[model samples]
Target: EKHLVLLRDGRTLIGFLRSIDQFANLVLHQTVERIHVGKKYGDIPRGIFVVRGENVVLLGEIDLEKESDTPLQQVSIEEILEEQRVEQQAKQESEKLKVQALKERGLSVPRADTLDEY
Candidate 1:
C-alpha cells in the first residue's frame, strides 16, 4: 500500500510499504522526500528506506484517488529548495531578534539546541 510517513525531524516521505516488523521499523520502496513550502511542494526520489520506528512521528495510508486532488501546487526541486532556504533564513533572523529583545529586558531564555546539564 502507498503510505505517507512523517519523521521526527520534520521530513515527509511517501512510498510503497514493502515490509514492517513487530518493532514498528519499516521498509519503504520507491520513496520520495516531499518538501513543502507555503502551498507548494516538490518530491525528490529517495529510492528505498529502512526507517527506525523511533524516528517516525506519523504514518498513514494514502488514498490514491484523493492524492491527485491536493490543493497545493507541485513545483520543481530547485525552486522548492530555494524557497525552503529563504524561509529558514527568515525564521532564524526572527528567532535572533526575539532572543535579543528578551535579553534587553534582562530575561534569558535557553537556546533550543543546548542541552541542560544533569
Candidate 2:
C-alpha cells in the first residue's frame, strides 16, 4: 500500500509500504519528496527508504481519488529545485539580519540547526 510519511526533520516522503518491523522501521519503494511552492508542486524521486522508527513523526495513506483533484500546478523537478534553493538563500539572509540585530542588543541566538534538533 502507498503511504505518506512525515519525518521529524520536516520532510515528507511518499512511497509504497513494503514492510515494517516490530520497532516500526519502514521499508518504502519509489519514494519522493512532494514539494510545493506557491501554487506549484513537484516530486523529487528518491528510490527507496528504510526509515528508522524514531525519525518518523507521522504516517498515513494517500487517497489516490482525492490526489487527482489537487489544484496545484505540477512543475518539473529542476524548476522546483531551483525555486527551493532561492527560497533557502532568502531565508538564510533574513535569519542573519535577525541574528545581527539580536547581537547588537547583547542577546545571543543559537544556530538554526541547533534550534531545530528538539
Candidate 3:
C-alpha cells in the first residue's frame, strides 16, 4: 500500500510500504521526499528508504484518487527549493527578533546548542 510518512525532523516521504517491524521501523520502495511551501509542493525521488522507528512521527495510507485532487500545485524542484530558502530565512529573522526582545528585558534565551552542556 502507498503510505505517507512524516519523520521527526520534518521530512515527508511517500512510497509503497515494503516491510515493517514491531518497533515501527519501515521499508519504503519508490520513495520520494515531498516538500511543501504554502500551496506549492515538489517531490524529489529517493528511491528506497529505511526509516528507524524512533524517528517516525506520523504514518498514514495515501488514497491515490484523492491525492490527485489536492489543492496544492506541483512546482519545479528549483522553485520549491528557492521558496523553502526564503521561508527559512524569514523564520530565522523572526526568531532573532524574539531573542533580541528577550535580551532587552534582561531575559536570556537558552540556546539549543548549549542544552547538552549540563
Best lDDT among the predictions, by candidate number:
3
Q: What lDDT tens digits, residue by residue, belong to model 1 across residues 17-104? A: 9998887799999999999999999999999998999998999999999999999999999999999999999999999999999999
Error of 3 at 95 (Å): 0.5
lDDT values for all models: 0.96, 0.90, 0.97
> Rank by TM-score, descending?
1, 3, 2
Rank list by lDDT? 3, 1, 2
lDDT of 2 by residue, 53-112 (tens): 999999999998898898899999999888888888999999899999999999998776
Error at 25, model 2, angstroms:
0.5
TM-score of each: 0.96, 0.87, 0.95
Structure candidate 3, residue pairs in collision: none
Winner of 1 and 2 under lDDT? 1
Clashing pairs in 2: none
Q: What's the lDDT for residue 61 in model 2?
A: 94
Identify the superior model by TM-score, candidate 2 or candidate 3: 3
Q: Candidate 3, after superposition: displacement of residue 43 in Å?
A: 0.3
Q: Which tens-of-lDDT digit does each residue in 1-118 have in candidate 3? A: 9999999999999999999999999999999999999999999999999999999999999998898998999999999999999999999999999999999999998988778865
